[model samples]
Target: MDCKSESGLEMQNVCIVEDDDAVRDALAELVESDGYRVLSYASAEEFVAGADATQVDVLIVDFRLPGMSGGELLKRLNERGMRLPVILMTGHADCDEVGLGLDVQDVSFLTKPCDPRRLLGLIGAAVDGKG
Candidate 1:
């Protein structure tokens, strides 16, 4: 389903699910600047309850959230038959531990204080069905 933005450009809708207000805002701004429409959420549960879930082309989630973890959210989405691409972000230095929590085949895991360019690249890959 191709979605057109008000600017007349093909816009990919991305959902940013993070508990931290600053991180969410920053991520939203960055993604928007990259020409994608972003919907920022405070938690996985909040995103799950919102209508934007079905409309997003990709989901950018934090590994640890207040209500539900990113992995758990992925599990729930899978069970519900939603095939949205997800990217996990974490502040932890242990990639192995993060790997253990994520079981999805195409998930992209990035460390916290993520580089904006790298995040944009990952998001493009995800939206292009390459992640």
Candidate 2:
């Protein structure tokens, strides 16, 4: 979907990297309703392979995946000089543990089943350069 604003201009691109089909679809719906372009991926590898740094403004990723983890993806993105704001979600009690040894910045953490309002607020802050 094209990220379009009310003034017929482009909006920030928000990517969702979620392995779970249900979660990915749900998030896409919610974020799209909020007017940002939603690019949903089933895995971090797909996102890494297909994402365009110039277009993406923020990322919402699942922290735990079947293969590469969210921290690894964030590190890879940073290594590639993307530097987009990110929100990582997980069920783990200590999500920060995954970020150990990573130089990731402009990142926020969210537990699974996060409040929709909170997620939207974070995305707004990230897009506005206030994250």
Candidate 3:
């Protein structure tokens, strides 16, 4: 799946880190259809273990995971100096919790059942350093 820009450059890679199988699969399909290379993980631990953090252009992470929370994962990434744009998804729309996650400059929060198009656009912006 080669997604080219106007200058004929390949699109960046996007990683989806979600616990739900259905959501992971669906998000992967949607992102791939948008012309970006997509990788899916069932948990934050799996993603952090398997994926090359440097290769990741954007990360779509669910706030609640089986092992570690999304914010915890982000904190780890920060400690390692692994900088990447992250979009956080959560079932809870708590302003305080979301605000805490937003303390990271490159992080964004999305409520559950997010619009696919908006998600894609945000991914694009993240990769382009425009978010």
Candidate 4:
């Protein structure tokens, strides 16, 4: 799970935006274990304020956040010309509900309680530009 390049620098960055502390921590741990650098935030606003979208390889976000829904965040990113691979995870909503205002490419949806292996696979595929 060493995702560093030949020079020993991390090659992939994964950002997780989830409002729940437990979920965010668990996701960060999972993604980090797979060798990707993980930066997590409790909400989309926090992510927007702290993260540099250009450095992100993949974004895993919750559909409903405390401030600025995941779909709106993606829209803003898209408007800024930052089209990164995104995985939208939700516990109560489906794609139709979450994608209402979303307009971006290289995006996928995963329901809550998503299989860890599937998430890892999606992250790998996203980093490889095949997801």
TM-score of each: 0.86, 0.88, 0.86, 0.88
- Candidate RMSDs in Å, in order, are 2.5, 2.4, 3.4, 3.2
lDDT by residue (1-131, candidate 2, tens digit) is: 44567798877789999999999999999999998888898989998788776678889989888688887888887787777788988787756576674555678888989999999999999988842
Clash pairs (backbone) in predicted model 3? none
Model 4 misplaced stretches (Cα beyond 4 Å): 1-7
* Cα lDDT tens digits for candidate 4, 43-120: 999999998887788999998887798888888888888888999998664566776657556788899899999999
Residue by residue across 94-129, what tens digits does model 3's lDDT show? 546655634654887788899998899899889889
Task: Answer with 1 or 2, whichever has the higher lDDT.
Answer: 2
> Candidate 3, residue 66: CA error in Å?
0.4
Alpha carbon deviation, residue 112, candidate 1 (Å)? 0.5
Q: Against the true structure, candidate 2 has what lDDT? A: 0.84
Better of 1 and 3 by lDDT: 3
Candidate 3 off by > 4 Å: 1-9, 93-95
Q: How many clashes does the backbone of model 4 have? A: 0
- Backbone clash count, each prediction separately: 0, 0, 0, 0
lDDT values of the candidates? Answer: 0.81, 0.84, 0.83, 0.86
